[model samples]
Structure formats: structure tokens, C-alpha cells
Target: MAPRHHEAIIVGAGFAGIGAAIQLKRMGIEDFVILEREDDLGGTWYVNHYPGLAVDVPTTTYSYFFEPNPNWSRLFSTGTEIKQYADDVADKYDVRRHIRFNTDVEGAHWDEEAALWRVALGGGQQLSTRFLFTATGFLSQPHTPDIPGIGDFEGTVVHTTDWADDFVADGRRIAIIGTGATAVQLIPELARTAADLTVYQRTPIWVVPKVDLKFGPRIRTLFDRIPLTQRAVRAVTDAIYAFMVDTAVLKHRYFRRFNIAAADLAKLHRFASIRDPELRRKLTPDYDFGCKRPTFSNSYYRTFTKPHVHLQADGIERVEPDGIVNADGSKTVIDTLVLATGFDLWEANFPAIEVIGREGRNLGKWWRETRFQAYQGVSMPYFPNYLSLASPYAFLGLNFFNTMEYQMHLMDRLFGEVRRRNATTFEVTEQANARYLDRMTEALGDSLFTLGNCASARSYYFNPAGEATLLRPMTTRRAVTEASQFPLSDYTFA
Candidate 1:
């Protein structure tokens, strides 16, 4: 029997995938299916249920423009609230009806002769589609460090993304590894309940105070009643974040002093908990502020002041059933081990599903050889009718909603072009891809995120080729504007 098919198959139900499905419906393209590995609709939010899990940006500007939520409990919504918003949006748009949850895409093969994407699903299921979109986010896959003898540990082991519900840390010794964004949030939560906590840090990170506030009933009522008032607040919040964090601290040269000054303030923030001068120095990062992803937390620093907390700067040597051994030969016994090591980056974190393109070529082969280049991060060469959300040098500013919305507009234009040409395939020309990357490379050389102290920090922005290819490297406005425009001649149709 022939397998089921659809006009398009979207491999995610997160913000990007949901946006694609909605836009497809809006464009009068109804025959589409969304494949989600998880049972729930929310992608990252669905997987991650750790304590103190919240978005870094303010909720006012952090959500979808098409469907804004005025009743956010806090300026920075918690993971629970974000997941609820995603669910609400899905319900409002009738998106869940088209979604196949628990359906993992094992692989994708492009049939050049048939002009269709043949995707392999688990349980020997197969489906074909005219187009395929991957929205698997970078941070969706939790990364556990490779410590020798890790399996020998008898205690409960957990990652922030896969936290066990019934595992209580109260009256238990807990040791957490890694100090990235997840650890910064999880440390404070564990410190409150655990009898003793030992944190294993590979490197130092700079942290600033989080600006979070609860919206009172009166404020929420005003926002709900006067929609324009909510819009005004969102605009103001977007402008502040765009200028203060992206433009002033990370992008523009003239305002770089703000970055340096902010680092000094972080040092002061650490001094509040760490009174010892040497310990304070240990907390300060040796590299520049923006080298690695900056975190916002008020409790992270203060949690260290607890008498039972131990911060280990040394690396891990091995793990035993009874305890963890440090590089310095010191051992600490714990009841639970939480891996806050963050995710494998960019190319390393690419979707595990196999993707075969033109002439029987696969995405892993082409992308590995070229080191992740594409036309505006959406369309790739030789990959006809294929588009993705988080591609090399295609990601825009901090606001993820804005980034997805910008890409959706670009996708609309490309799909329209396909309709106009009456073509089954649309792949970027090699010359066009090179030209775009050439100009992008030159622009990236000037950005502090790339040309500055990021090299010393071993940031995920840099790919396996030792090039910073994850970021778009342009101002948010310019990047989004450029993403929308495409010379039809740049793509070849058949």
C-alpha cells in the first residue's frame, strides 16, 4: 500500500514550526502535517521543566506579535507560562488538529525524479511531502559531559531538561556540573532545598541582575482593556533590549564602554555574596563580557553565600558509584548529579534525522564539507523545497519571535515565487550563496561578537571549521530587512 502524503511536512511544533503551519494555512495551503517527537505542542518549553526556568528577555517583547499575551504574570515569563502561551496559541489557531505527536522523523530523503520529500517515520511509517521544514531548536537536545566511569554512579542522575518530578533534593547532597544559562538558574533553586550543594564549573561566567517584576491585577486589567497600551509597552521594551543589550553592549563600537562597565557591575554583584577578595577574583571572568552568552540572575550570586555550598573550579576526572572525583583528586559524595552542561552547538546539534537532497546527496555530507552556508539561512543549495529556521549565519537578534516572524515573511515570498514559476523545485544557486556569504563574512569581521574576545571564550557561535557562523552578524533591523528581500534570479527552478 502507498504511504500517506501531504503538501508539506513540518518537523517541529515549536515557535518556528507553528509559525510555518499557520502561514501555510493563511496562504490557502491547507494540506500540511506537523511532526513532533514529543507528545506536547511546546518544543523547548515542553522538554524543560527545571526549577527557576524563565526567559531572559522581558515577556512584553519576548512573544509573538500576531498573538500577544497581555496577562503575563511576570515581565519575564517562567517556562510554565511560556508553555501555556504556546498551547493557547495552538488552540486558537486550530494547529493541534494537523499535528502528529510522538511521531519522530527518523530520516528524510529527497526524490529528485518524483519531486517529493520521502520521510521515514518510526514503526515503519512513511510519508511524502512537496516541502519540508525543520524547526528543531539548538537547545532542545540536552548535552551530558563525557566523564570516565559516569555509568558507575549509583545515585540519581539528571539533566536540567529531563528533571525527575519526584526526586527531592531536600536533605540530600546534590552536585551539579556546568555553569551555562541553565546552571545559573538551577543553582539558586537547588541551594534552597539541598542540605549541601557542590557546583563543578569549567569556566567563569559574568552575570548581571535580572530585571523581573510581577504585573499586578490593575496593570493586567489596563493591558487587557486598552490593547494599545500593551502594544506601547511591548514597543518600549523591544527598543530598550535592542539598544541596551544588542546594539550598545555587543554590536556598536561607540557604545562598547557600556559592556566593560557592565562587567565591573557584575564584579560588584559577586562581591555582595563573596566577601573574600580572592574568591571574588575567582568569580570574575577573564575574557570580555560578550564573549559567551551573558546571563541575568539575582539569586545565582547570592546563593553562594550559603555555608554548605561549595564551588569547585577544577575539572572532573572521573565518576564513581559513591562519589565524583575532581581533577585535583578531591572527592565529593552526592545523592544526585544534575548535568547543566547546555546543548551541543550549531553543526554538532543539527537534527539527527537523515536528510537526502539532490543527486542522492545528504545534508550531513554537503553541510559538513561546506561548514554550514546557505542563502539567508533558510534555503540551501541542492536542497530543493527545503527550508529550516536555525541555520548558519541566519539567526537574527535576541527576540526569537521576531526572528521566526521575519523568516516566515521570507518563506512567504519564496513560496509565492514557486507558485509563480509553476516549478516543483527551488534551490539556491552556488554563485548567489557565495556572494551573500562574501558580504556577510566581511560584515561579521567587524562585529564584536565575532572579531572581539569571543575567540578566547570557546563560544558555540564558532563552528567546527573554526569560523563564527551561527549568528547573522548584522544589526537586527538590517538583518530582518535583508532577510525579506530576495532576487528571484538567485534561485534556479525546475
Candidate 2:
């Protein structure tokens, strides 16, 4: 029997996929299906429900620009609220019907003769689509550190990505590995109830104070009644974050003082929260503030000052059945182990699933062998009719909505041209892709990742090649402008 087909197949029903679906519908191209691996559609929000999970980015700037939710309960909304926002946006845009939950896309190959993509699914099912989009986010794959004897451990082990609802941490001896953004949030929550909490930190993170204000009824009413009021708030929030990204990361050499000031703010926060000088020293990050992704929390720093909490910076030697052995030869027995090791960004998640483009050019293998890149962080050479929403240099600032909004503009422009020419296939020109990669490489030289000290930071921004290719080295305005105004000649349509 012939397999099911659609005009477009979007892998991953996350926000990015939903955005893409909305864009397609707006373009009068509605014959598409969103394939989601999970049973739900919230992507990271749906997948991650760890304790104390909340938006690190401000609620005003974190949501979709087109569909802003004025009813956020807090300045930094919780994971449940974010998931509900996703659902609301999906429903409002009428894209929910197009989504196929629990549908896993194993691989996809470009069919030259058929001029379409053949997507392979987990249960031996195949689907064909004229255009293929991979919206599997950067943080889609959860990374488990290869600690010795982790497999032989007798206790319950939980990765932050797969947190169990019934797993109780109250009064239980617990050890958590990693100090990334996720760990920063989880640690404080665990510290509150755990009888004994041990945090195994490889590198300390820079934390700033989170100004999380609960929204009052009046504020919500003001936002709902006067939509422009919410827009103004969003603009202000966007500007503040954009200033941080510009001065601290994008143009660190010219504005190093800003970076220093930000670091000092974190230091002041740390000093105020923790009383012990030794503990403060252990908690402080040695690297520059913008080197790694910084987070904001009111209670994270103070959580370490608790009597029962311990900070283990000596590194992990191995994990035994009962507990973990530190590199200093000390051991701590724990009943539950939590791994907040973050995601495998470059290795397992660049192209989350196998993608074989024209002439058997594998996307993942090509990126690793050569260099990680994508033209305008969307289109790639030899990948005809394909768009990768989570490609390299796509992320803009701390908020993902900035990137998504600009990419939506790019989609509008690119697909508008495709419709103008009445073309069935389109691919970015090799010269164009190469030129864009060169421009990105040159521009990154002035950025914090290149000029700033990041040796001890262990940032996910830097790919395995030691290149900070994750964020585009330009302002959000320029990104949107370029995305909308890039030359149509850059892509060949047929």
C-alpha cells in the first residue's frame, strides 16, 4: 500500500514547528503535517517539567511576537504556563489539527526522481512530502555523562529531561551533577526539601537576581484591554535583553566595561546571598559573564548556604552502586541521582535525525566533517526544499522568539518568491551558502566567544570545532532585515 503524503512534513510539533505551520497556512499552503515524537506538542516545555522549571528569559520577550499572551501570571512564567501558551498558540492559529503526536521521524532522504522527501518513521511507516522541515530544537536530546559505574548504580537515576512525577525528593539524600541552567533551577528546589543535597559542579555558573513579579489582576486587565500596553512592555524587555546581548557578547571588545559590570552584579548577588567566604569563592565563576549562558534566580545562591547542602567542586571520579566518589577520594552516599548534564547540541542534535540530501550528502556527517553552518540559519546548499529551524547561527539573543520571528519573515519572503515563480523546488546556491558562512565566521571574531576569556566556561555555544556557531553575530534588527531582504538570486528555484 502507498504511504500517506503531504505537501510539507514538519518534524517536531514544538513552537518552531507550530510557527512554521502557521507561516505555511498564511501563505495559503496548508497541506502539511507536524510529526511529534512525544505524546504532546510543547517541545522543550512539554518534555521538561523538572522542579522549579520556569522561563529564564522574561515572559514579555519569550513568547511569539504575533501571538503574545498578556495573561502571564509572573514576569518569569512557569513551565506549565509556557506549555499552555504553546497549546493556545497552536489552537488559535488552527495548526493543532495538522499535528500528529507520538509520531517519530527516524530519517529522511531527498528523492531526486520524485522531487520530494521520503521520511522514514519508527514503525516502518513512510511518508512523502514535497518540502521537509526539521524543527527539532537544539536542546531536544538530553545528554547523559559517561560516568564510570553509572550503569551499575542501584538507586533511581533521573535526568532532568525525564523527571518523574511521583519521585519524591523530600528528606532523601540526593546528589545532582552539572551546574548548567537546568541544574541552577533544579538545585534550589531540591535543596529546599532534601535531607542532604550534594551538588557536583564541574564549573560554577554566573547568576543574577531574577526580578520575578507576580502579575496582579489590574495588570492583566490592562494588558488584555489595551494590547498596545503589552507591546510596549515587550519592547522594553526586548531592548534590555538586546542591550545585554550586544554589549556583553556581540561587541565585548568595544564594551568590555558592560561585561565587567554584569559580572560584578552577579558577584554582588553572590556576596549578598551566601555568608561563608569559602562557599562564596567556591560558587563564583572564574570565567567572563557572557562566556556561558547566565541565568537569574532569587533563591539559587542562598540555597547553597543551607546547613544540609554541600558543594563538590573536586569533580567526579566515578559513581558506585550506592554513591559517587569524588576525585579527591571522598565519597557521598545518595539514594537518588539527578543528571542535569544538559543537551548534546553538536553531536546528537544538530540534525537530530538522519538527513540525506542530494547525492547522498548526509547533513550530520557533512556538518561534523566540515563545519557546522547553514545559509541564513535556515536553508543549505544541496538541501532542496528543506528548512532547518534549529540550524547553526539561528538563535538570536537569549530569547528564542527573536530567532523564530525573523525566520518566519525569511519563510514569508522565500516562499513568496517560490510562489511567484510557481516553482516546486528551491535550494540555496552553493556560492551564497559559502559567502554567508564566511561572513558569519568573520563577524564572530569581534564577539565575546572569540575575544572574551571562555576557556573554563564549557559553553554549549561553542561547537566541537571550538567555533561559536550557535548564535548569529548580529543584532536582532539586522537579522530580521536580512532575512526579509536577502536577494532572491541566492536561491535557485525550479
How far residue 456's Cα lies from its native spot in candidate 2, in Å, is 1.3
In model 1, where do residues sit more than 4 Å from their true spots? 245-254
RMSD of each: 1.5, 0.8
Which residue pairs come into collision in candidate 2?
Answer: none
Model 2: residue 165 alpha-carbon error in angstroms: 1.0
Cα-based TM-score, every candidate: 0.97, 0.99
Per residue, candidate 1 scores C-alpha lDDT tens digits across 1-494 of 88788999999898888988888987789899999999988898889889889998899988888887988998988999999999998998889999999998889988877889999999999999999998876567667788998888999899887888787889889999988888999999999889999999887888988878999998899988998898998989988877765654346465677777878888878887678777677677887887777789998877877898888887889999988999999899987898998887654556456788888777877888766776787777878889877778766666778778778788888888889988988888989989988977876655666546665666776777777777776666766676667788888987
Write down the lDDT that model 1 would get: 0.82
